[model samples]
Target chain A: MNPRKNGILCLLLVLMCGVLVLSGCGGGGAATPPATPPAGGSDEPAAGEPINVGLNLELTGSSAEFGLSGQNGMKLAFDKVNAEGGVLDGRMFNYIPADNKSEAGEATSATTRLVGENVVAILGPMTTAAVLGSIQLVTDNNIVLITPSGTNARLTVNEDGTLNPWIFRACFIDPFQGEVAANFAMDVLGAETAAIAYDIVGDYSGGLAASFKQTFEAAGKTVVREEQFSAGDTDFRPIIENIKTAGPDVIFVPAYYTDDGRFVLQARDAEVTVPILGGDGWGSGDMVGIAGAENMNNTFYVDFVYMDDPSLQDFVSEYQAAYNRAPDGFSVLGYESAMMLVEAVKNAGGTDPEALRSALENLGEFTGISGTMTFDPETHNPAKTAVILESVDGVKEFKQIVEPK
Target chain B: MRWTKYLIWLAAAGAFYALTLALSGAGFISRFMLMTMVQICIYIIMALGLNLITGFTGQLSIGHAGFMSIGAYAAGFLASTYGGRVSAALTEALGGAGGAAVYYIFILATLAAGAFVAAAFGVLLGLPTLRLRGDYLAIATIGFGEIVRIVLLNTKALGASSGLPVKNSVGWTTAYWLMLLSVVLIYNFVNSSHGRACISIRENEIAAETMGINTTKYKVMAFALGAGLAGLAGGIYANHMYLIHPNSFNFLKSFEILVMVVLGGLGSITGCILGAVVMTVMNNALSAFPEMRMIVISVLLVVMMIFRPNGLMGTTELRLPFRRKAAGGKEDVTHGL
Candidate 1:
């Protein structure tokens, strides 16, 4: 063999050795022995490096608006906490956001990667299904997930009616919001009969609609013409025509902004003259322009909390100054979630996820933008009040807050 | 020479099996690595089967995932419903054989069932659409995918939209090893005379027919076999993940499989393995940069296609990195034991 060729081969071998060395050294972090607590009762930043805090929020795609809102609120909360000299005595928090693509599969892959990175905790994916994926992946590695917007009833419920210990949500779920809408319908509108139209594919929409029906029936009003449609179904004329024949005083359309806006317009065009009611999903400003003011008159909905209160007036102003728009229910949920996560970390006295999880479970009197919340020991869902909103000229004007009975 | 090749292959297989055993019971990182390797092995099986038709035999199937979904749900349902009964029957038949025997038979039956069903679906899909051009075939398959998803999501008998859960780990481990072995068997099969005929059809249909190759029959057979292997992967995945949701096997999954085959180089076995491993690693690495991951992946893919479209290894198996001395001066494959 030529010496030059031999040298080249030797060089390649060295390069391969270097690569192997790097990979081995890199993976050594996983095998480190567990950290032992300090002997003394002193609480400091462990004398060396500050622990890295991970924030995995959906930062782009179909739910980009919600993700951006979550980003802003979390940034604000972190800024405020760092200003007051950080949690665990100046262990600074760092944020690392990932896009969930508004898809569960993407969320699973993202959570898996975060596990590999060995982050202490994750913040938001905004949607219930996305949160569900993160919960299973993160909890296996003892990583805490604090989500703000996922309000599905099943997030806290197992098949055998037990609570999932690893997952916790800041926002009140669908059943509470549904009952809020139900009470508002009975007390405010004095309606006798209601028609229902909901999306079949969306678990949230279906769950909320069912809760609303249960509450409405419990309140002594009959529900007529329960019809279902899928997400992105453009035609709602048949459903409207069916509802029109039933002649209900009010109709409940539990859906997101995109379909809710179109449903309102189509229902009006088909001469279905009835007041429309929805849940927090209908709190977007885009709905106002999509449905038009004329079509949205006398529409009532339930949401996290109303932003029109005097205490929340400054937040609304600040949000408008920052993003140039009135803060919606989603924005409020994001803010509350960030606040709740911070509170849990502070209460735990350290960034340890297990300690923080217990702190979250025992969380009491944490005053948030939405309402004061306390997670019931049995279920990780926050026990709080739901605020009702009435759409006047297509804008969600505050009505009243309903306390859960 | 062929015996030597077989010996080398057997040694490699033994080494890999040993590696899996060493990694499986290791700490967290090693466990994760092995799990990922198992996933890659399953994906390779699916991609290789797809390659048989789309690469060698020339048939288009955009809805390969639809057949996979069927296989997954079927496995999940069977495992949950009649698992105990089947185990008992197998135990009764093979009196003192114990749990291992039951596990072996159950997994074999599941794979066979999956292949049979997937092949049936392929034939059903192929009979009408064989005469159609490429794009039309793509559209037909896409429609089939959507239809299957809708049906699976709504069918209450198959657990409806809630999804079917898989709970057996032994079944999954068995399936993974099965897939790895099947991949090797497929590599050998594709290098055989039948595969030569299939490739001839791919190179030129009319010429292959003039050479007495039954183009239609071979194409259908290739598609059916590809679909069968995809189904097998689906069955393994269903049992391993412990949840077989209809949504898991959609058009997006088919696209990912396509990306693997394309990146691996269409006709190369080693290339397929390299592609699958690299893509999975890239996927994990880019988790931190989710917003920019797609951009990076897309750029890499485009650059690769633009430059080395033949892929890292083109139409070749992983050979000894040595050259043999020919009639010329000493080549690189020299000085063997």
Candidate 2:
């Protein structure tokens, strides 16, 4: 190409990109009025304005299964609330979801963008590491954030032992889930020794593994083996071989369904027929599908609620009807997140951020698919029961329940 | 004539900064929008750095993001641990604006230290892969980047996979100035005799060697300089985002920087700037439409590659009225864009 043509092409490239950026940024807040300034009085919105709820989720990368399910659940709750004449003086909640692309940096960017959209409160970013990335942003913005599935204990509590004030989660913290898994393995499975393999790279997995080790050892049990695997490692046969040789009565793999599913399959393939226990990371519907039900006979994991519970049957059906798919643990947590946040908004009587925050800080019992739970006033994590489910005939059957003190 | 060029650049920078402030003041640029601007500047610095190594020089270093990760972690550690004390000390000594300026200067120094470390690694990487060429060199660089990422992933003090928080007080203006400096320095470097040697190597390494250019020395120099620039960008980026993760500087990020260098034209400084801006803008713009964003971007890249295989600028520099005439005021045939 000639120099003139190249110049023209470069100019065209710049023009095209420039126009796109303008169009992208300019498509903001034209249809709805700006966030109402906090004016002490609780009054109706003049134009039926929306209570914009921002969602920063991992919708398109690793652990996307969690984010997409959580987003869908939140959408269903919003649709139901909108159908019921809305909340906070009949103002519908306009849910704005921003995909974090399953990266910590992208999570921060997504949260920053969502916070700029005049959202009343932000929810989600399903994984713990992604939640950690966005916590500082929400703290800086003085906006409330409720992650649907992120259960890292440090998210709501800082290293200095102070409450983060703005960050909360619908699910219980990792330690609690860890304790439940440990208790089930010890009491239900009658295991004296456990072998553990965890994802070293995941905040959720690492924290959960540590918590399980502590809880199990505190209960006078032995941890025979401890193996570490990074997030995307597919070779679990070596780790499984080590765990088998360690002669532990049960194996605890507190990793995500993506990694743990293959580990279970490999362990079974190696003829290590001991019971395998796991944390909430294995609570996805896709988990059993990965390990295959025949190989998952003695495999069990802690979850927020059971899908086939009589109490959650309505939510399960409603979710399936809405999305044409079964609800996972993240979906249930996300539904409860929306339900609790909307209830708080209604109680606060306005979309004022401070009022909404205080209302969320004092959220009462929210009985939904995730079982009855109320946010702890100190830590902002819900005090809820964790259920253990076993793979039974190609389905997750409720095996046991571990209630929080 | 030199003063005119310098004056024009300063004026342009001032105008751009003022426009940003004006736009933000008028509510056109939100916090997120300004954040995007900072990111764009950061990426421009990085892309320009890669352009120097792979574009101006014949060395195709694919481990640019590895250098970036090193700089980011170094800056992150410094800012989070000592940034407060250093800023306080500077402010105590200078007070107010002077103190703030000095604090920013201290941040730049930390960034420079990061660049130094990254350059040291670049030289180390270069020594081992000196004889390798083309795809073999690319594979080696890719392995180097992966090793850096994996190390960062496993380092507990650096927050492991949880990511490190950078508590530096830097912002868009810092990024803009740093990027401007990078572009100016790289532009000057590309015009020097050393740059001509590098370009000759790009054309024909054997011919360049026959012409008495120390191929080994120049190759290592190119890697060091390019890595240092990327390190500078990484420091600013970590400060801007306030968090840095190993995943942020993965192989995909390296490939993205390489794409910017290739798409902007293999040997054009001005083209790299354009490429960075376009790519970052396209990413942000398409965020408003998530479903079709990937499809659109892939289509654009494929079309651009097919239509302009030499790239958007094709070895041409952006023609400016204030730019000094090439050498003895005769019309230059090399650059006409």
For each candidate, what's the DockQ? 0.26, 0.62
Best by lDDT: 2
Model 2's CAPRI class?
medium
Clash tally for model 1: 5
**DockQ score of the complex predicted as candidate 2:** 0.62
Question: In model 2, what is the error at residue B25, expressed in angstroms?
Answer: 2.8
Query: Which regions of candidate 1 deviate over 4 angstroms?
Result: A1-56, A60-65, A134-139, A313-328, A351-354, B16-35, B80-116, B156-176, B210-212, B242-244, B308-318, B323-337
Per-residue alpha-carbon lDDT of candidate 1 for residues A1-405, written as tens digits (9 for 90 to 100): 854354345335434643554375355544532233446745434733344445666665567788778777776667666777776657666555666666555566566555655566777878765676566566667877778788877776776898778777778888787777777777788888988898876577888888889989987889987999987788889899999999998899989888999999998888777788998888754888888888888787887777778878877887777778667666777777777777777788776678878888888667886667777778787788887777787666877878755
Best-fitting candidate, scored by DockQ? 2
Give the per-residue lDDT of model 2 (tens digit) for B27-108. 8788888888888898898988898889877677888899999988888788888888987888898898898888877788
Which digits, one per residue and each the tens of the lDDT, describe model 1 over residues B1-337? 6577568767877787766666565643443354456667678888888778776666666887887887777666777677767777767776756765766678668766876787788777777776675778788888988899889877877755456645544333565577767776667667667777878887888899999998777777777778778878777776665456677678988877777777766776665666676666655445555666688678878876775575545454444454233213632111221
